[model samples]
Target: MPPTPPSTPARDEARIRDRGDACPGALRLHAADDGGLARLRLPAGRLTAHQVEALAVAAETLGDGRISLTSRGNAELRGLAEECGAELAALLAEAGLLPSPTHERVRNIVASPAAGLDGLGGPEVQLWARELDALLCAEPWAAALSGRFLFVLDDGRADVAGLGGDVTLVAVRPGAGQEPAARQESAAGQDPTAGRLHVGGRAWLVAGADAPRAALAAAGAFLDAARAAGNGAWRVRELPEGSTPDVAGALDRAGIAAEPVPPAESLLVHAPPLAPGPLGTASFHVLAPLGRLTAAQLRALLPAEEVRLTPWRGAVVVGAAPGHQDHARLAALDSHGLITRPDSPWAGVSACTGRPGCAKSRADVRADAAPGSARGLPVHYSGCERRCGHPHGTWVDVVATADGAYLVDGAPTPRTALPDAVTTARTGAIARAATPSTPAETTR
Candidate 1:
């Protein structure tokens, strides 16, 4: 079983931000120890084959020769020259990846990657994401949103509902005699065309056609609550205690009829990520090792009509031929070093940019974590205590220490023992044994 998560911090202990977030976007590049880093948000993680090729070209010519996948289903180009910001922006814009300059940073959105292609789940929520992105860009007020604020759209499969989102919209599964429509309420008082909109701890039933606008309204409500509280909260979870956003009121003002759902009945269903493999007959899911893809690996996914990056640090290649042909494609991806099987050791393994790239890092954690063995739980290797790009929920936490050693789940271990120690921690053997005593500090 996954270990229980720690309790939420007290209101007084919550983070208080006095300045805006400095998250990098296509228009805004962040200067790191390695070089300039540009984050391009792919709402719903949708990318055309041409867009993929364009990113490959950008990475090879302007920045690092590799692309890094963020936990939020976004892409990052590192090792860029400071003067290439304008050029990078132009490249992305030409590829249609940068639609709105003002709303670039705030375009953080993730949806069920296998929605319509998988033959499971309800109404395709990817379409909903596109509509929401358009609505967000058109609204000038949305530019005020922090770059980290996220909107999650689940296709009733519960794939993305668990990902922490400021605003979440989940399609409601239709009954035997029902069909999805627009703004139509059934005789039983249920809206067949409605979805469950969750903001903070509250949830409401909203029409499918109105869901995109309702999601934006929810964000606006959060902004209002944050302003009233003067907490400068960037996410809904960061709002002051007891100051939940007035989502219902916001919906009412927008002329969107919303039905309040009781807290007990509004609990979201959590589902594991879509494992790497073929999904039904239309899509092939594959993972990038350590969430980094070489230019060659990126091109290996070509001939795909569309690619949807998943929040799990993988992608769903859509419009693939079924059966033998899809299997052949998966094999090709495997040849190029992508994780095409769930049993691959690289599965559930992630690491933050360490070593020369991040000045704060004490060691090259990624280099050390590359030989990791497969285990039951996910394992994340962090260069420092900040634990950037860590996975959500319970997992093995490996942090590099000042003494040039590692702390596997807080148990100090030497560098030479990392492999065995990490495997033990990930397999739950460390949790079952008596805690080890703190050892004397030692250099690697």
Candidate 2:
């Protein structure tokens, strides 16, 4: 039997928001200590070569000379002049990056980075992502969605199905028989290309062709629930207790046939991010060190037809040059300081904008957490208690302290011994629960 959907926290335990989300966007830049910060959402993380060039140009000309990748497969440009918003918007509009200003921030979508390239996955879900993006921008109500709202399209590989999306659609391969319960409501007949739509803890089986619309309808239902709850909830997961979205009703109202199904364990499995290196004969995957890409490093990925950013803060150069040319391109990227191999010391290490970039940072965590040999587990360095940009799932948490020392999974370690401590913690040499010196705080 399928497992019961987990229950949400009680009402008293729910976090009630008091204000609107302040997520920065291309047009709505956030004032940061570094300067104006703008986040550009890349649905399906798709970017043409020209678009890449445009981003490189924008990073060099308008903001910082570096581009930071967000965990959600988005790009961020920091240290911008406040008045450069218009110029930045114009530049993005020219590159076809900004389809609609109203829907720009709400266009958070992540898809399988290796889809259509590697033969392991089902169908090309990126096509669905593109269609859903167009549908989202055209709909007036979609703009009400919080910038944090996410849509994950897993192309049967289960790579991105666990990224905590508000609405997740995983393609089902042909001949993969459905559960008997799901088959009972197939009045519209079974589709050869079927997909599962998951919202909160509920799941539904819908035709692959109708998955996009069904996903959108699910989001609308969440918005309705959010409104009724009268709490400033940003994500479907943040809705009040007992407020699970009525996805089946929404899909029915949209004239799309769907079958209520048990949430699949495979969808929520913690799949590691795509490894960095050659993905296929025609594609190369690489990661930006510390999730920050200099203009030179970003350009090194160019001369390709297309690039798809991954949720793990990496990019896949698709349709790469053939034969010996591909080898040369890979070498160029490695020389430019991009992580071209999975075994690199920087592979599982990430840090937030510490010290000078963030006023809350007590130490320069990035400088201190420089590259070293690969550890057994992922490690993240946070400048403050609010660990921004930390990796999901099990990881070694390293936070800077107020006393000029550092915490390796809550164990106090002097600055001089930080490297060894971090390595030891990542290797799980000493298994202990993290006990931060300061009270735990949420990321801004």
Candidate 3:
């Protein structure tokens, strides 16, 4: 059986300060071992169709013509030649992508993918997401946050909210008794928007006027305290003891109402939205075998549709043709190992770029963990022992130990005896080793 999930520790109060976050942007790409890397932050994981075309164009014209989806719901372009940096930056800026030079990298925000499209008559979670993004963009202090820091705006459904974001805004469904008060002062005359706001597992019931604004203010408070502390922490949960104020206190400073809801039965799972029905279009998800894309593939992608970069180390190609992806198109994608349906062995498998891509990698794990070649739940490929992009919630963990590769969930099983460790991890069954001669695992 899988190990019992680890319990979340209480928030620490220790203050942390940082020189600044080193997150990269399209304008300012980072030179990695493999090549130049650029990260494009996707606030709320939402994009317009035109912007999608621009990204494909940018990837082809500037970098290696391949696009990568990051674990932060952002996009990356890799293997760029040094000569193209300035031209690439200028092209991205012209596309309305690189907004603020100083603030480009720190604009890390994630919102539920189903926010606006969900028809639960819920509050406009998308509205709150956009409003918060605007607030972050306008604030100078927010730039102090590390590139890894994250903000999640979840519609009470808790989808992206469960991904362990530093800041979260969850919607509350109001009771019938409050309907009269809700309508008279509601932002969009909606019932879903009528409930209290919660932060850091604490609740705040604000007057309708202060609800949204206070949430932004609350984020500011967290940032302020984090900067005051000396530690170089990126998230609120990482603050030193007594550094982070209680959620109620933060709201008190912001003048927002406070309340507490009963504990939830299950954390939200971000399964891709099912294909759209006859009347409307539905968003869809797709995975990049190694978060690497070719220039030709970029050009071939439909430019009119916006794409979502998932924190799951995959990209969701939204606005797929309704009913189902065209059969021939599906075949073409399959030829490239980009599976659209759920049953494909590639469904739950994800790996990071090892070997030539990352200096700390122990092996070229991607080449060994090719899609369909392996099978398993939440399988992750790591260069060294540090598992960087492993899924946060629940899934099997495959790590590269000094002795050999190991499967981590409860116990660590050495790869020396397994027939094919890679295939076993991917498919969830034991098999013979596919290749001989194991790569030596090293630690720094």
Q: Stretches of candidate 2 above 4 Å error?
A: 1-12, 176-191, 263-267, 371-373, 429-444
Question: Please, what are the lDDT tens digits per residue for candidate 1 over residues 1-444?
Answer: 322223344555556778877778888887888899889999999999999999999999998899888878999899999899889888999999999999999999999998887678754588899999999999999999998899999988787888777899888755522223332253114544467899987888777888899999999999999898887888787787877899989999999878777677578777777889998786799999988999889888888889888787888898866667999999889999999999888899988898889888899988888435675777878887667777655668788999999888888889899888877777765432111111110000
For model 2 the TM-score comes to 0.91
In terms of lDDT, the best-performing candidate is: 1
Off by over 4 Å in 1: 1-8, 176-193, 370-373, 429-444
Error of 3 at 108 (Å): 1.3
> What is candidate 2's lDDT per residue for 285-382, written digit by digit as tens?
99988888998888888777799988888899998867567777878888889888888888978888887888889999888884434857778788
lDDT (10s digit) by residue, model 3, range 1-444: 543333334446433343554556766667778788888877765556666677887777776677776656777887788888787777767776777777777677776554544453254666665676677778787677667667766665555666766666555555533223443244324434643454455544454445557667767777776656757666666677667635566666765654544346123334332221211244445556655556555444454265555565444555555556544455565566564566555555666667787787766676656443433445656666556555555555555555555454435665443325445554565322211111121110
Instruction: Please give the lDDT score for candidate 1.
Output: 0.81
- Candidate rank order under lDDT: 1, 2, 3
lDDT of each: 0.81, 0.80, 0.57
The better-scoring model by lDDT among 2 and 3 is 2
Candidate 3 stretches greater than 4 Å from native:
1-19, 118-123, 175-191, 194-198, 205-212, 246-282, 298-305, 316-319, 322-336, 370-376, 402-444
Give candidate 3's error at residue 42 in angstroms: 1.0
Candidate 1: worst 10 consecutive residues by lDDT? Answer: 435-444
